[model samples]
Target: MEMTFPDAAPPFLADAGWAGAAIEPIPGDASARRYFRLRRENGTAMLMHAPPPGEDPEPFLRAARWLDANGLRAPQILAEDTGAGLVLLQDFGEVRMREYLDAWPQDEREVYAHAVDALIQLHQLPPGPFTQYSLAEYQREARLFIDWFCPVQGLYVDLKSWTEAWEEVLGPLLARQRPGVTVLRDYHAENIMLDGGLDRQGLLDFQDALVGHPAYDLVSLLQDARRDVDPVTERAMLEHYITQSGAGPHFAEDYARLGAQRNAKIIGIFVRLWQRDGKPRYLDYIPRVWALLERDLAHPALAPVARWFDAHVPAALRDPTGRLGGTFAV
Candidate 1:
């Protein structure tokens, strides 16, 4: 039987007058939020399943409007039932920019240029209301490696020593932060939607936006965890952004600092996904993430954390376990 929403719709969706909508689950990212691409005789929408007490749509709505006002593309809110942890959003289509670029690699430069321009525009906007991605937050995220990952690897972390090492590692980043901006905390290729609009770009997964250094999202784009961006292309995008944005002299240094910080956090997060969330798929990306982390640690300022990793975690565990080390993107 061709399914419709009446029987399948949850209590909330049925109450929201979507009882007859045709719905299909869309692939989701590494978030608790679930999505269903929905179509009814009246209109089409994307239904977000953000089970509250853990997920909320208010932040997403706020960030979306803010992005829309700032000359970028975020989805329009169709309807929201925050109390039931559900919201209906304008469907921005299924074509993620990553899929588009990969299918048509010839257009990568132009597409990435547009993405960079979006970041440049975002950097100029005044800070938004959110968690400040402060040194304390960075430290807290990095400690996830010690808390969740170490035990799984059959190792003990010396918290006191590790804390001091991170403090030293984070010193240069703290001292050289740019004025805060609304950092779309996960502004990577996958989160970018190829909405066929004037901007040709739409942002997703930005509910976790933060007030932090401008270079943070830049790192997220150029040093992607899920895909391998070619080095020449990556360099061109960086130079283009610097020229267009009139970024200060410390841009490269700050970028490397934040890149390493982000990659370190990924190590912990990937492990947590496996340990607590029962998702082992993230472990597959550890090799790529580790390679990126090594490059980040090449910055002289990050040596403390580098030394700490070497001392405790051992070299073998840095990459994915067993044969994953060999399949790295060249």
Candidate 2:
């Protein structure tokens, strides 16, 4: 594949130290950014090609420093050219957890347990000045569903009717919950790497880390993209997390509720990605997420909201709202 950069390659790479480096394109996430593996006489380093002025690397750098300082495996920054939006970082390689899972399905439990341990390690950190994710921010993100997906489906929603209900149900639910340390907002299969000899996994794409619910990142991992985890395995992992963290029996209930909320928000996000960003591949994962939401709703913890959904929201609308594979005009 041809290399894609937002702008021309930086002039520094042609200088004395980095001359004759081999620059190879590396896989990236769902962002307008690119990465290259730069192998030079100095050593192997990863170059991040984010467009100047639009996508600043400062946040990523700061988050990386914070995570690295706290016993996590974030890429170490080696060199940076802020003016050109290029950053040289430790090469964590391109083996995503999704690929590893595909190659070794039998190791899913053990591998996922490691990820759970990582989450526990992260949540153990004391509160810091990192970003905070509030109900208002979540509501703002939820609007993407109305603005993007609803239009694509040719369905108009009375924002006044459901918006308040959503906020009302979720507002206190999130507000009353105990706050945690930083959360790696996108800690899923694609963002983790199982390096061959490394004792711990490598973390990537954590620039959006926030101080939010303790279970949020764990839910993001076990309930992931690129694969469907068996319900039996999901329960075991949930129990393992609860036990290992000493969060007590109520932890399971809290985990289920948070998982439901997180899954609902993600469904909306995937739909918005398809409708607005033209990334329709994410639509394939809708069924898995919907199944999770439905299963979570079955739990007694969510009975009130689930009953509301069953009564006010039609069964046909459930799958559509969940972005399952159904052709609805737009």
* Number of the top-ranking candidate, with TM-score as the measure: 1
- In model 2, pairs of residues that clash are none
RMSD of each: 3.9, 3.1
Query: How many angstroms is residue 234 displaced in model 1 relative to the true structure, after the best TM-score fit?
Result: 1.5
Residue-level lDDT for 193 in candidate 2: 80
Q: Please report the candidate that would top lDDT against the real structure.
A: 1
Which 10 successive residues of model 1 have the least lDDT summed? 1-10
What are the lDDT scores of the predictions, listed in order?
0.80, 0.72
Error of model 1, residue 195, in angstroms = 2.1
Clashes of each: 0, 0
Error of 2 at 302 (Å): 3.1
Report residue 40 deviation for candidate 2 (angstroms): 3.9
